[model samples]
Target: MSMSVPVVGNFRQVPEVAQAGCRITERPENDLTDYAQLLDVIDVGICAVDRTLCIRSWNAFMAAHSGYGSREVIGRPLFELFPELPQDWLKERFDRVFDLGVPSFTSWEQRRYLFSFPHNCPINGGVESMQQDTRLLPIKDELGRVVQVLVCLFDVTDAVLLHHRLAETIQVLEEERQEQQQLIARLAETQEQLIQSEKLAAIGQLAAGVAHEINNPVGFVMSNFRSLEHYVEGAFTLIELFDRHIDVLPAEARAQVARLKQDMDYEFVANDVRALVAESRDGLERVKRIVSDLRDFSRVGETDWQWANVHACLDSTLNVVMNEIKYKAKVVKAYGDLPEIECMPFQLNQVFLNLLVNAAQSIRERGTITLRTRTEDDHVCIEIEDTGAGMTPEVMKRIFDPFYTTKPVGKGTGLGLSVTQSIIGRHQGSISVASTPGLGTTFTLQLPQRHTTAM
Candidate 1:
């Protein structure tokens, strides 16, 4: 006997499925019989429901999985037979198919299964139930009206499990890649820091040698200068006594001596000698002060923490880099009362040198670099501000990152600020920066007054 069977097709007449190029078709009675047999024998679950949600057809796959034979489920309300289904949501899907005469689909990703059938594979034991990919196709009558909706359930439990496993594997791989990148970055930073430390050590040694050599010559020169000043003063006094005794000489002799004195320009020489001596003394003193500043700044072999004056450290650092700054910017010292702070003096000097040199380099033309210092409770606050070409927000964000630089290739190694920050951290201190593009930039350092072992 021939029975009605739904034929799957591209429902092109339905507005929603038109773009999808789908339409339902009818078959002869003999062909319908063959189709029904094909549906019953197939592994997929096939069933049909009418407008009142009554089951009209049930296939072998549905009967086997649901444990309800065709005779028992047919003509029964679908919701009554399988009350575990999402009645409202599933009804809406069926209603749309019936009214539009189009097919609707739900993947296993969207919903695990339409019916609670345990998965058949014992190997994939992680899944508790069968995962299904479901579809609803409209069954049309001869007059082109939707009489019922055909539901097809595909067991996609394996595919769903594989997808979840793939996603988990990908997530694990991504996390590993991120960790490797972070490790590589940290290694690069550590290497750069080591190189910088070696360079600083070499520089300190060189500075110590130079300071020692200069001190010897300076010491003797200063001693000789004192002796020369004494002799010159004695000669000047003798000349004054000679001038007072000129009245006792013969008039012709006195006239002769006056003429000789005028020819020698003795009075001018006496006055000029004092002026020359004063200027020489001042120059020597300046040299001595510079040498002293250099020695203090280098502090080779002085790595242990010690009580140091912050202002003194800054001044010594400024003196060491004065040549670099003098040509590019004018320096202004706005000092305030500050107490001694325990720190690595040479390292602090390095920090100040880096900041001061950076401030000088930032100015393309002549500008002012102002050094300000003050006491803030238990900390000494120092600020190096420059009226130069300042940084953009983006540049400022990465300024302390190792090996990140905006300067010309050879002009910067990009480790200066990074090293400066490390030194501050070692001192149990903090450094912060503020900048405006056209106006200027300021780097403030706050160092604690006492050293802590945690640092």
Candidate 2:
């Protein structure tokens, strides 16, 4: 049986329906009031409950969707018809409206649906439940006393789901942007490393060629000088023998010999020739040492580990940079007894050379550059200290960063300390610096006695 009372009247008799001019049904014997007429035709879901929580009205929209006809649910308690409802909260909401006669509202964002009605859109295929926006209206009697509450629900499923998907899309794009930035940074670092390697290779080749060419000519000249020394000595001996024999010569011959000796300054030439020859030999020896140092520094294929004296490598490096530091700083070596360490000797020589040159350039005037070494347990320590104008704290912080320079633009390439650090790292060693602005700077290197065979 249909619990909805069909409206049958002169439609003009129900003023609310007459205002909208809704036509009446044919049966005039079953009469209907204006309120019931209006509830039957509205688009929103509408239901009215009395103070006792008994359903007083269930409209056509509510009846068709809830699977409960008006006859079955109208006289029952609201929760008895729908056991899934939150009984306590719904009762409180009803009590507030019945007691105070005020309205209330809730959105689908806060609670997805109140009734769990099926969303029968063909586009969605009814996979998801309907989303709702609900409102509660207080119904009052003539003296303004609340009698019943009307519940209205609006479907808002599409808008809420669209907003959720847009937020997720934004988050995904942001993560992809951050990953691209990191890849670009890595490529830039690799490019700089390749450029530096090519520059080092070219320098090594040039140094090796110069040393080889100079060595051949120097060897022949040294041999010729030695033969000339012997010849000059024999000539001096002949002159001395003549002085002894002068007493036996004729008077005229003696006068002529004495005159010739005085005119030629024979004694002075004899003494000076020996001195000049000795000085020339010493100069040649220095040239030989310089060539040896250059060859060691610029060797290309000495990458294997070997037992080498750290002190000897330091001495060779010092000789190589002697002219640069000799005028500006006096070098003082404070050597400590240390065992031979297994290392790449050529690479370590490069480290020492860089430190010595930096110490020399630090001094504004004449100062003492000290090289100190010590053995601590299984490791070796070397310190290069200069009594020169030292670095400030800011300069010390980034001293090893590639291409970061405190020197004037053209005077430095800024890779000296950075390359020194790389070689030390390869040897399983550490380097550190300490400085004060007015006093001086010291660089300390701590190296393991031996490294593993791994490169």
Per-prediction TM-score: 0.62, 0.63
140-179: candidate 2 lDDT, tens digit per residue: 6535667677788776766656655666677788788788
RMSD per prediction, one decimal? 8.9, 10.7
Q: 1-455, model 1: which lDDT tens digit per residue?
A: 11123436432222222211123344444343344566678889988887899987788899998999988988999999999998999999999998998889998878878899977774454887989999998876657677778898999888778888998999999999999999998998898778777887788789878988998899999999999999999999998998998899999999999899899897898899999999999989888988887777667446799988888888888878998999999899999998899999988988999999999999998999999999998999999999999999999999998888899999998989998998899888999999999989999999999998854
- Candidate 2's TM-score reads 0.63
Clashing pairs in 2: none
**Model 2 stretches with alpha carbons more than 4 Å out:** 1-186
Q: How accurate locally, in lDDT, is each candidate?
A: 0.84, 0.80
* Candidate whose TM-score is highest: 2
